[model samples]
Target chain A: MLLRLAWRNIWRNKRRSLIVIGSVIVGVIATILMDALQNGMIHQMLFNQINLNVSNVQVHKKGFKDKKDINNFISKPAKVETIIKNQPHVKFYSKRVITFGLLSSTDNSSGVYIYGINPSQEKSVSIISKSIVKGKYLDASDGREIVLSKALAKKLNVTIGDKVVGMANTPSGSIGSDVFRVVGIFKTASSEFDKTTVFIPIVSAQQMLNIPGKIHEFAIITDKYENADIVSKALQKKLGKKYEALSYNEILPLLVLQMDLYKQLLIIVNLIIALALIFGIINAMLMAVYERIREIGVLMAVGMKNSKIFSMILIEALIIGVLGTIFGIIFGYGINALLLSGGIDLRWFAESLSSFGVGAIIYPKISLENFIQIITIIPLVSVVGAMYPALKAIRLEPVSAIRYV
Target chain B: MEIIKCENLQKIYQDNGVPVHALKGINLTINKGEFTVIAGPSGSGKTTLLNLLGALDKPTEGTVYFNGEVLYKKKRRELSRLRLENFGFVFQAYNLIPVLTALENIEFSMMLLGIPEKERREKAITLMEELGIAELANKRPNEMSGGQQQRVAVVRAIVNDPDVVFADEPTANLDSKTGDNLLNLMQEMNEKKQITFIFSSHDKQVMERAKRLLILKDGLLEKDN
Candidate 1:
């Protein structure tokens, strides 16, 4: 009977109930949208970083991470490659030689990092060939051919079929210089990579730098990203102290750290929104108690105990919470779909984000877990918010309450 | 048998730093199955004494015994429980819960007593019929006339079958004819059900229906007959 009374009481003032429900809906929608956007952007970033830059895992000389000089290379590449090929989880691997060199073409001269790879093997790891904007990509059989980023090619006044001079330090402490024909111009979405990297054939780089039968780094691809750490540990044990295995997280710690920070920030934002909605609900309930003062007095006077009065008020709050949460979830999903379809445009702030190698358009993606959290949090906010007003009604004296207008 | 006894009861109100004695050493007793009226003008300690007797307020001094148990010695929660089981009340303004229908308002007291729904509904319906407001059972307090609302309030008070019914100006909001009818209803219920009916009122109709009258003047009992 008390439950029936409480349920009926909520609809007695339709306007007040709507105000509270509206606030909850707004709060839930905002939280869902923000959470989805953050999750989507971070997922996109991690995907790009792993596939384009650091293939799930990479193997380097034991001390190469601390100092990537001309001396750090796998001396016995044939044996290490054979071992990696035989591993069960290892799906693909690419041998690459990375070094800093100066590029010069007539009037232009700039420092650039060169990545030398077997073209066929590199293709299995990254989509660099598909990113070629101008000219033809270098093939494994092509001799003395290289690919330059469009930005770097433009700065050096070099094009396809044009010869450029590259200079780097050799293991013998002597300067190695060579002439290379630009066969392709690649365009990475990130400005940093587009302006600074030059790709060349691994054998040609090995011969020119006088490091025959050696490779500096071997990027590995696995069946699943979550198994990267497991495969890396297995590789470390198999290769012994000669090689060090690094996962994507270890290679790009800043990105991983930023993702963690984003999660915390999103939680705080959601809490603030929830708190604001709860305050609005509390305000509405308090006013409701005041408006029904005489009614409450009458219930007490007719032999209804103070505890029953308290429970009835609490039940009213519970009903409000359940109704508000149902509408909130619906509203949240609707807003999420709208935002997801119409991607957010941040072209004006592209330059600012470009500094961190992130894109302008942010796409929001929500998971089941996040949706469940939103649903759970709203009801808790309503129930907790209703407590103060219910207690206030319970504390009211029957005489005074009956006298109130 | 004495259902209510008060000994030298006192109640004081602080009015802007001055002590105003609302009840001053008043003594009274009410017998079971009697229609008793505590009659006085406004601010003559009738309501104050009624509140103390109903266990709604703590007396400034002395004690009240209801059915041989001292009420003032019980905890607030215990007192509330005792009041729920032992007393029903009707106020001057016809305090019917605006959110509930007339039938629901009467059934609320039985619900607090944890009575089963089917039984409570039958009792409420029977009481509403007895009070001649059975047709208005579905109407909210605001939807009914002042007299109809007051009668609903009366049914709500006695629906729990409490040992005592405390009514503070039960007919104050009704017309003279309605007020007279309401008093007669209380007297009839007292006679038929053997349920004690106690009221604090200045209304002549309420005073005339009383089998026992306790008159108060200047915060003290002046006459008892």
Candidate 2:
């Protein structure tokens, strides 16, 4: 009966109730969509990093990560490959001999990290093969053929079939150099990565750098990106002391830190919205209580307990909050579903986004965790907002209230 | 048998730092099954005395007893329980909770007493039938006429079968014919069920129909019969 009374009382002034409900609806929708956008952008950045060349995990021969010296090569490649193949989570692995060298053309010269890759093995581990912009991917049969990023190709003033020389120091302290014809040009989300990296057949790179059968790193892709740390740990434990197995997070600490900072910013945004919503609910409920002063007095005079009165007000606010949250979820999820197909285009901010390795179009991802959290929180906030007004209603003196005009 | 006893009931007010006495040392006793009127002009303490007797307000310098129990000595929560179980009120404005239908208003007091819904509903409908307002059962206070709202208020008061039903100017807002009809209904309930009916009013109809009358002048009891 108290519930019935509360339910009826709210509708007595329909406009006021709707205003409160409207504010809650706005708060819910704002939180949901903001979280979706942020999550989408972060998810894209992480996915691009993993897909490009990082794969899920990387194995370096101990000191190679700190210094890409040709002497720090993996001497026992066969042993590491055997152990990696035994791991259940390993989907694919590519052996690469990586060294920082210089590439020179007739028009320009730039320093680059030349990746010595087996074409067939690299195709399975890196998305560079699929990101070919002008020419075909690297092929095993094409000796002295190189894959250059479009930015690097432009920087060198070269095109497909153009010749460039790659030069690097060998273990014997002498410069070893090779002339290669650019067979492919690719573009990626990050212009920086695109301009600073080049790939060639492992045989040709070993010959050019004067090292044979000496691997530098093995990039491994796991069955799922989320299991990268576990797979990296297991491999690190088995291949102890001689190798360092690093997950995507360990390999890109700055990116991981930025993602964490974004999540914290999201929490702060939600708190601001909640604070504004609390004030809205409190103001509306206080007005409602004051409007019904005489009625409340009559209720008290007729023997309704103060606690009952307090609960009645609280229930009214809860109903308003629940109603608004339901509509907000419907609309929030509706907008997300509509945008999930084509995605929201951030081409307007493409330069800034690509600097962080995020694509132009972003698909908003939904999490049931976020929805469930907001669903429960809105009504609890409504109850909290109503506390003051409910207390005020209970504090009125019945005798004076009955006579209140 | 005495249902209510008041002793030297003094009620004072502070109107802008000056003490205004609404009631001054008036003693009275009301018996069971009595239809009584406390009559006076404006500022004559009629409503103040009624509020004291009904346990709606505390007296300035005295105490009230209901069926030999000290009314004001109990806690505030206990007073609420006492009112729910033993007393009912009819205001001059026909104070039915505007959100509720007439039937709901009539069942409200019984609901506070924790009566079963079916029992309370049946009791409310039966009382509405007795008062001849059963057809207006589903109408809210705004939808009903003044007379109909007041009839609903009266049913709400007595539906709990309280020991006393207090009516403050019950007919002040109605036409003569409607007011008399309301009075006739209360008079019948008082006579048949022995529910004590105490009223504070200046209306001649209420004064003439009372089995006993107490008149007040300038916050003092001037006559009693």
Give the C-alpha lDDT of model 1.
0.83
lDDT of 1 by residue, B92-172 (tens): 888777878999888877878888989999999988887788999899988999888888877887877788999998888
Deviation (Å) of A176 in candidate 2? 4.0
Q: After superposition, how far is residue B2 of candidate 2 from its true place, in Å?
A: 3.8
Where does model 1 sit among the CAPRI classes? medium
Residue-level lDDT tens digits of model 2 in A350-369: 88888889888987876565
TM-score of 2: 0.92
Number of the top candidate by DockQ?
Answer: 2
The runs of at least 3 residues in candidate 2 whose Cα sits more than 4 Å from the true structure, single-residue gaps closed, are: A63-72, A169-175, B67-69
lDDT per residue (tens digit) for residues B1-225 in model 2: 999999999999899999999998999999999999999898899998988888888999888999999899988899888888899899999889998999999888898888999999998998898789999999999999999999999988888888899999999999989999999999988988899999999999899999999999999999998
Tell me which residue pairs clash in candidate 1. Answer: none
For model 1, how does the per-residue alpha-carbon lDDT over A292-314 read when each residue is reduced to its tens digit?
98887666655567777887777
Model 1 stretches with alpha carbons more than 4 Å out: A1-3, A75-92, A234-241, A302-325, A367-373, B116-119, B122-134
DockQ of each: 0.52, 0.73
